[model samples]
Target: MHSVNTRTLDLNLLVVFATLWDTQNVTRAGERLALSQPAVSHALRRLRERLDDELFVIGRHSLVPTARAMELIGPVREALGRLDDVLQGSTAFSPATAQRKFRIASGDFVEFLILPRLIQHIASEAPGVMIEVVPLPANNALPSLLENGEIDLVISTPVAFGAGLREETVTKVSLLTLIWQREGLSPGRFPLDLYLERPQVMIEMHQREGNIIDASLRAQGLARRVGVLVQNFMAMPVIASQTGYICNLPGPIAQAFAQTFGLSCHQPPIDFPEPELFAYWHARFDADPGLKWLRERIKECANTSDE
Candidate 1:
């Protein structure tokens, strides 16, 4: 292998390389980089000569990356991300005029609770900014997602994250039991006997053994019958309203669903733990002004959610 001289390499070529890797088509890559297709091709040609490898070849519909290009992408992305963070740290982030997109990973519960207020705020204060929210990956993949710059932030219930990640408790919320108004459930605390007797609609996001509610019930030598198991919190309200099943959800979400679906919210019969929603990010981008502003905005939304 021939070692390439870094002094002669143009940093913009790496940018083109990374963008080309993301978008296999040269035309699409050129559009993303705001360069003409010919310019992109010229840069790719220069990069191929400098690296002495055919980094990409024309495929049926797109440019397929050679094995060498595949091996180079990860480190290139990491380096570019680090450089961007450094530049962003030195620049002032004026949300009012800044045109940037933040990618966030979160569950639907966060979407229902925090996003409305955040979007409204952005519309008035940061009209040029964009927000993209994606579903949270598996528990183990979160750290890598943040470290690799795949996601800008994560909003989720408290979970163990790997090293080099920073976490802050955005809000703490207690569980509320949701029941159909037609069931004639009282306005106060739900009865323990009735809670156990009624079939429950459980939100099981992961395939874990049991949730906090189940653990508390087991401590009391009791277990509620899970009549229907679901992977999303959005489904719980509809299921409970139609089937008369009980679902325990976070306070804000429970209230929101109850109001939307004309259900009732009551305190859970068991002693349920108040789960804290956390915002997770990689330590590498700790000084990024845009991300810092975003975190503050999220905290503000969470603080006002109950109000």
Candidate 2:
């Protein structure tokens, strides 16, 4: 065995290896790679020498991969696939017939607002494409998930991602106060005094003991009485509906909940910053055609806010 410096290795050899791995026959592999049979043999020879292994051997009708070649094939194939994707560019993004999977990280608020429309659009137009929602706390939970290629995008309030990350505004969503119609709060508006006095149901987006709403309220030298705490925005309506508790939820989620659970939506009296949901990705994927297409679809779906 020899210690080969990868810096001096020809990447073309991996292509030869990949082509040979797929086709098995030297002639077929050479035809696929647009190389003569001799050129393919030469490339394989170099690859074998560099790796200090007989990567493949001539069988009756096909080349048999050595145990070492079998071990390297998976990563070699993956690398070549990624390289092909890169070389193909945005022109190859045909959602209609493309079979691809996208991983997105976001909370229930964003999911509740956009998933149905997004899913329907994908199902109707890009039947073969798939969307996987990597649940949050996911964005914060896995610090290196995006950088390591574990997830494609992050949809969240502009959080600090240090470097090699890019964020694009998906949508800005204003906060709305949600209360049961039975609570008898005035429609269209919630008075600050009544809001402070009412028992509130809080959605804990972060794992912290307190919520952003409480932090905002404290900044204004005021506090609301939170009587219950739920994990996601979806549960807020359920708790508020049955318990007559007021909850501060995103406008889109509140609107959906209002229609479904007979809840009332009111503009909060206190001044609060609207949460801008941003689509974040690693800088490496900034020019990726597939992710670009996915991002556009996400933006379309996220553009649900009336405000």
Candidate 3:
């Protein structure tokens, strides 16, 4: 087998070698790689001289690699992949002293309920870290965005995957509760039918497919006419404050929004499942060290907010 003079090679030559072997012709490889064809040809000549054999030879309008070139392909590709592995593996998040730009996307309720404390944490711990909160999308492709390096991380309860996606539960929310006039309602949880029938109001994302109110009502063979339809949780307090309408929302969400809107919250009279919030990442970043640090900081932020 032909051998290369290992001592006399620059590291980037391996990249040139791999590209030529994959495409065979230097001209085609250069075109594929956006290099001048002559540069690729010159690179190949240097590789041939350094290796003591022509790596490829002219064939019918193509270039055919020599036996040594074919033998080197697998190992060369593996080496490049390993290099990537070495470069992208670890994390550090000492928020008390970190400087980073963190991007997040979620509903306004989560913004109101959770993020205030996280911001405070950053202010104290990683004063250099800045938060860029994005408005919620109807159906965000967060996993893909993570892979493509668009958004850094996602925070929400709902998470699913086609592939290469992961979500770790950041927090589990309490069941939906009612936000009613503080003076009139019973002190404890309300009765389902009474709560449902008592001039109910619903808040839903405008672009969301269907509201839980509609689905739940249909499931139990019962339905309550919605007295109000608003897009954001921000309005739940304002609308529910003076009106007798009861707002059905996640306990934490209702409680938080109520503070802002001057309303109140309680467990619904009926039983319903609680929602969850999670931090999701793409597997592509599974080995990314910087990402690991970001995840930890986010987890810390979310966890500390609960306390």
Q: After superposing candidate 1, which stretches have Cα over 4 Å from the reference?
A: 1-89, 206-209, 259-262
lDDT accuracy of residue 141 in candidate 2: 42
Provide the TM-score for each candidate, comma-separated.
0.74, 0.70, 0.64
Q: How well does candidate 2 score on lDDT at residue 96?
A: 88
Candidate 3 structure lDDT: 0.67
lDDT of 1 by residue, 1-307 (tens): 6689988889999999988887888999999999999999999999999999999999998898999997887678667878886765687799888999999999988998899999999999999999999998888878767865679999988788866789998988788998889888778899999899999998765325457788888899998887888989899999999988998888888887797887899998967888888999988777788999999999999889889
Model 2 C-alpha lDDT per residue in residues 65-182, reported as the tens digit of each score:
8999878875675566577667776475788889989888888777777788889889998999999997855445444567446788888877877755788898877889887787
lDDT of 3 at 280: 75
Ranking of candidates on lDDT, top first: 1, 2, 3
State the weakest 10-residue window (summed lDDT) of model 1.
203-212
Identify the leading candidate in terms of TM-score.
Answer: 1
Worst 10 residues of 2 by lDDT: 136-145
Better of 1 and 2 by TM-score: 1
lDDT of each: 0.87, 0.79, 0.67
Q: Model 1 Cα displacement at 9 (Å)?
A: 12
Model 2, which residues run further than 4 Å from truth?
1-90, 137-143, 206-212, 305-307
Highest-scoring model, lDDT: 1
